[model samples]
Target: MATKRVAADVPVVRVDGRELRPGQSFQGIEYRGKDKDGNDVWRILVYAGDKWVETPDGKRKRVVKTDKHTFTGTFRDAKKFKAKLEAERQDGTYTPPSKETVAGYLREWLDTTARRALRPSTHAIYEVNVNKHIIPALGHIRLQKLDSNTIDRFYSSLEDKLSPATIMKIHTILLSALSKAKADGIIKQNPAKNATPPRVEDPEITVLTQEQLDRLLETAKGTRIYALLYTLAYTGLRLGEALQLRWSDVDLDRGVLYVLHKTKTKSSIRAVSLDDDVVAVLRQHKEEQDEIKEIEGERYQDMGLVFATERGTPPSPSNLRNRYLYPLCAKAGVPRINFHALRHTHASLLMAANVHPKIISERLGHASIETTADRYQHLFPTLQAEALEQYKEYRRKHGKGG
Candidate 1:
């Protein structure tokens, strides 16, 4: 009779002079020869205690489950790692490796951890990135098998299809997810820490000149979008932030508006002062809206939004951009610009008047003064030249310089 081959009965793999066998125990550490990269490889097998399993005859047998690691480093490093593993074993802190896939872990994480921690809008973005981009590429890889090189390759693959700034956003999401996995003891470390993402250059900011802005407002005057456009230009608020504004949040008497919802950060929730012209425009806008509400009666869907459609519902951002803003820019004979450029226009106007950067940072609701400074640093050279000219004029007047 021929004997059936068992897993342990198979041939042993010889690396250099060392013998490697399946399920074999090591004293502490063993040299496993060099890897493909010519780095010395070592193996460590630590006993992880045992459990009971049913035998063929309905009897019970003790099955010892060992935690093993193949280290790609020197034997000395392997010994140190072995010692660490032994220490963890002594304290019952070591986690056995898992065979879960990246997709499985990410799905679980998004449903439980990320959903609880992230805001609704932010969480929606994360979900789209994960389901649409990440899972399709890296989902098949085992969670334990994922490494920095794999992540780097994945990022490289996206270079042709996505912009550097967009790729950076994806990297941020992956890094956050992997960081949580490490904290939960699901992975030994975050692979994203070593992965290299594409570099994003600081883009040249676009802003409308004061004359161009005047023409734009003139073209948009008496139109429904005028108030929204004026608000964005003067307040420097993001399109989403302005759209989320409520009637209650605006105080026409106090000459200020509170940014309560759709704010990017805690710093973004601030009181933005309104100019007299802006206050007057808003008061007129309110009266017109009240008349429309009375005309619509109960048919209007009033959600207290300051900017809404004729039915009192929030207007679509795409419609505002394509249907209104672009056409208005053409009619006004001004260079076409996105709504965000209006915010830049406001900041540029303030900077031209020599407004303090600290006040600018506060008004823009930047997380730090450094952020504001870094963004507008391109405009500083002209300001510096002007300052030097002013100093020279002062010296000439006082007869201090020839």
Candidate 2:
């Protein structure tokens, strides 16, 4: 009979290395060899203060933290490792990091601090990065054992498969989490502090020409999603902010909306003005929704979303584009772009019409006018052309040049 090959298991960080209780003093170092670096490496040791820690091979040993010549993070070959510890003891210069694993600390941080500090959507993203990416790769390494070189190598491996933006996000999670560990005295210093993360390019913008926008609206006018399409083009609400909306958020009489949620920063929350056209569409949509509610009666879920499935629940944002917007865009003789193109299109249209950037920022719920300007920087060349023409006209009128 042939034996089947089994995949090797990954190493796990051990939490019981230094079991010394406070007020109990530890003396002497045990010389253990380089760890087996294999399955039997999972030797969990527990000893009374005076007893010896035995290696799996029957010799006595204890894995201690070291700053140099490390075999497994801080763990080194026990003979030289013991000499270093003894010297540190004589000099009184040794400080030990906690025996916590990277995975363990990250779980705690997410459950306690990150869950409270970040928005739900943002927390979800962080959770995915930590649990899915960081944990699987570095979880076995002790938090104190984690070093810049290890982190850099991990990032280098991800570069081909993941975008620099994604790698940067992973770096941000590590830097922030490790900084917290340092603050709590879990580690002496964050190894990630000096690590280099990948550089990210500015987000690409996609805006439609006025002719395409007109054709799209003309085709969309009487469709079920027209109100949504029009709202996106006019108000620039992100797909999430738009989908998360309730009837209460819309003020038809005031021609405004209060955007309470979106991805990224908290600064994305702001009030947006509705054009008269958008207000009219919203009003009609509301009346129609109200009539549907009356008919559906007890069966209506009443989620209060402005855009919803026929059953009144918020549909997945991804599905909304493929099912409605993309097909409609194709039929309308316009090149298809992602749903966010409407936001870019809205901002571009405002800039082309020479509207103030502050108003554009407010309408788009951007954190600042600087953000608006940066996003629309591509449009500024046309602005310069228009300005040059105005300057020539002024010169002709004043007779300074002919």
Candidate 3:
């Protein structure tokens, strides 16, 4: 009833309206067919370079084409291919707002919004949180597609792995990034707005007893690093802030240290009185630094940093911790607490000494008095006992017996 169909490879491919040369590659094929109504239908078969591709519904599809061509396949096959390609094209059109990840957004937010508006020390802390925690976990996720569920899962996983304080830091970073994204219209919603950070129950702060402090000072004697530990424990300066200090910031005559710049907290900028012992140690340190500068000759940069390397250059935080602090603590036979613990010790000692909470708050440069009170609330019983004793003394003076 019908003539035999041509063999499957009988040179059916055409190029530029002519039969293709033998052995020439069939870059693609094109054809036209008539339906029952005799309407002409056209389609194109694309070569590798002729069309662009995209993924849609987890499948590959052709999104764009360079040239139009006719089709040879059945209508059903043609329609299916066209639909898949269209889906891919449409999906490609729906681009996320930014190409950056969650971590990248945090950096951008800090540079654009925080650095200009917030204090320098505050910016530094945000930078730390972004680098140490947030980027490592969720930096690869696209900003627009980062939904609440994704953030919830990230938090849940962090809860199992990190300390509560560390988890809280991660949450703070995410909240800040999402808030900026919302304000900029990069995201339609703030997924982190309702999220709760991990609860950080206060732990007992360790303070060096007077005897231990004396032993530490004795052990540190005759070493240049001793001045570093003495400064931290006696003055309560943070390690970064201490490292950033310049000789100019010290007021030896007035026995005061001006903390105008800190490498840790934004609120850690205030003047503090120095004890005589601390002043003496600093004076000795300055003399040692000057001698080293003389030895180094022109190599010394004279950066004016109080805690500097032998070359008179500013000391890096890591190098100072490894080379000086850790080794000195080990030699002193004390538990190897990090440099930050020195700050805790200072606060704890002040609390133990019954310093006013408001004064402590101002000295530490905390954002609010409430934060200071919350941190040292455990010392209130001591304050309360002192108050009761004062009341008894008043009663005794006024002839009101117990």
Candidate 4:
């Protein structure tokens, strides 16, 4: 049934044995019939004060603004909401109802604020989440109509189809986008702050032992991606970081790599030292690349990427995974692991060798040593025992043992 505005002459409506009337907080509360479940629905009216509006002739006129919020709960609930609306209006953070759909706003946000502010890869991720997941579920709803309850329900609906980690990523996108909308005064507040998302526990990290690493490298010895895999094992560079490396970024003489772009954080944009073996491997790879460039002549892309396809074009991750990584792991008889496992293998091996955690942190480009310690906390006790054993060995050598 449609709801009509309550006139001043209407009889008082008794709610919970209390007579309700217009007061400082609300102008009136109307009983808008029961909902589908037979619960009384009350529409609370509040004075939203005055606002300057433009007329058809382009002249500004001051007009009184009023707000009606429909609530499907007890009388106390309606009163509380009325108070909240009045407070929002007084503070100038009240968002009037708008017809802007969630999909329209999110797509605009992705094209404008997110494009210039986020890295290209990050922007692509946002675009995918908005189009593939978020928009399909909640895009048709008005921007201002989005509430915490709606978001909570949406997250629950995705539980069967997506992993908790993937759902968490979706939550992050929504929270970030809605926070921007709030900051821009498009919404009164961020509803995402109150919505609950699934908790994602850190997965077990898999790394190869020295023997396994040897077998994997041996299997990749003569392959085109050999140098890239070798660099990952020796330097612990991320797959993206290693793939995007340029000839200018690598210093063979100094045995160092300058990571300038596509990094996860500001701390990731640091210099990483290379092992002598890895440096030599890169030198040979460079020679091989130069010969290919001469053979291909003008067909070569000349992007200067250190790890590229035969035509000097950047290699896709899928190609690296499907064509090389999987086959090499199978042939080498090692456990099939993703590219990131090589980075873990490198870090774990260094820690096993009694290298300082600070050095490991810097090498891995971690934001802080604490991050390294937390990530590899499982290995510290053994390292500590080894340190004590070394102390005993030193004492024995000096003839000061107990």
Candidate 5:
């Protein structure tokens, strides 16, 4: 009887043909290898065209040269390769997230929430806070794993590294992000909800004394930055609001300046009475702008801004601060403070002058009367003194002596 053949019993290479030419082809079944146990591991027949071919034999395997220049070689056993390919297909190991970073999420949140619910300028501020501060610190951290302890550590680092107001802004950004995360189910709860932000001490405000104000005005005469300083001091308009102001908003005939729009706060949309000093400064400033327009002829772009660059674009906050406000303060020999501090100085001086808190709130366009009282309460006399004065006044006016 003929002996049966097993795959491992065969050698690695075999062939049926004896010799090969330059341009012919052949077919064969090739066995890749066998398991530990010797077995005839068979695969489907393979056709080779002009390639080196592995031919299987009962006792030996051999490489054969075909008629063509190269012959195709096929594996007779493919259990291992098949298993690996199926496993790789099942694993599915190559995909990326829809949103990748905190900065990215913040931008999406601003587009979706802040833009829809808040003012455009308010949304712009949130974008500034995210880009300038928050993204640099913790943007790489995954939103889902952001815990209260992580936020606490971030706030602690900011308190030591940055200004109090900057830290407060960072806290505000984190709170807003985490609140959105909770709403979207990215996190179970807001980590920043109960997180204690760093307590910010109010910085000292620089208010010009009457002597200092008079001296500064005298020094600012004949300069382009003069009326801007006067408007900041007298009307308490923020830098952007002042820059956005048009001649139409100013009713010189009615002696009232209408703050119909603002860039700082949403509440800053009301009218303010123009006192004599403010009116006089505006008149002079208008005359200067008109002269410039006459000199430039039609080349000048006229937006009618109360405060604008000579070329007619709006004045940038930093440009106004550095080039105008700072030099003016230095020249006038007054202590330098930020343009924002001008607003605070206006409020503080009003409180010192015993202006009613309600009126001060209205002038500053505060959302609530309590906001004004809370900010300026320290400058006022004690509550007891106020109560005693009220009682005395009431008695003097209404009490009848027997």
Candidate 6:
């Protein structure tokens, strides 16, 4: 007689040993026996893939499979575990992991999922970090073996070699990849869950003072990049956004510019109200562009870009920075910040003038007002102080003070 009766429902689990590789035999437990405590326990068996082993030891150890796994112990905990395993199998969202390494999984994940899901530039960045940083550092480790402690040590080693910002980017890619692995059931848990990456240091925003702005603009007068740089300063436009502007998007009479195209983010699409002075500068720029177009005749590439070279092509950002903006900044004796500082200068001037963050966010084409506040959080306390002072004066006049 059988020692114990098998239950109709059990979680079928497969835990294989190493002997299956050579094709001489296979090794695993067949869920068909009872332990000394009268609870069912698994028994080991060998197979040749689909065929059962007929050797004396194999036959003695073997038992039949009925799509059920052995279970024992207290009714509650065992039932819960069995249900979970069965649910996972039925849903097909997960499976037992085969022999795979972390590097192999990450490469496949990037190629199959991240490459198409992320934006082109973002994918390029992920590719660089994965291929250069992550795979090289921990590729040999098995997916199951990776742990938060290992990742923490890796981050610690990189502390002195990479900036906090770059390290954070690398960590973000690893976390994302590992997260996908967990979701796919390739691993039981994501090792990066509790991993500590270097905290990103707040970047020092380079905002040009009013005096510096005056000098830089004055120095840029009559220079090729004057209009481009001036528009950025006056309108709080990001460098890439300013470069992508077109004539049709500008409404000089109404003093408005439609941001129909942005080089970086689609969320930045919105209309921006331009200052009267900025409109005048753009008008002058348009006239100059026409003159250049006439001079170049058929050779000019008229793609309608607002900021372009004499040949009507959009000027390379690096070329414009090195050949023009930097030299002008040096001549003006300013901090010599890059073209992006002009956008910062614009936002700072607005804040100094007591403009609201929502308005600044719109002008700068930021994705959200929170982005503006976070980027300029250091300036916000000063704004609060100024407002309180104004409130105090109002209260004094109303009756509180002589």
Model 3 lDDT, residue 354, Cα: 71
Alpha-carbon shift of residue 107 in model 2 (angstroms): 1.9
For every model shown, the clashing-pair count is: 0, 0, 4, 0, 13, 0
Tens-digit lDDT track for model 6 on 214-262? 9999999999989988898898777777878898888899999988773
Candidate with maximal lDDT: 4
- Per-residue error at 263 for model 1, in Å? 2.1
lDDT-based ranking, best first?
4, 1, 6, 2, 3, 5
Residue 234, model 1: Cα distance from true site in angstroms: 0.9
Q: Each model's C-alpha lDDT?
A: 0.86, 0.77, 0.70, 0.87, 0.68, 0.77
TM-score per candidate? 0.82, 0.76, 0.64, 0.83, 0.65, 0.72
Query: Which runs in model 3 stand beyond 4 Å of their true positions?
Result: 1-142, 159-161, 262-267, 386-402
- Put down candidate 3 lDDT per residue, 53-121, tens digits, no spaces: 656667667555343434334444555655554464465432223566776787778888878866676
Q: Comparing candidate 2 with candidate 5, which one achieves the higher TM-score? A: 2
How displaced is residue 101 in candidate 4, in Å?
2.7
Ranking by TM-score: 4, 1, 2, 6, 5, 3
What lDDT does candidate 6 reach at residue 380? Answer: 81
Task: Give the range where candidate 4 is weakest over 10 consecutive residues by summed lDDT.
Answer: 18-27
For candidate 4, list the clashing residue pairs, or say none. none
Best by TM-score: 4
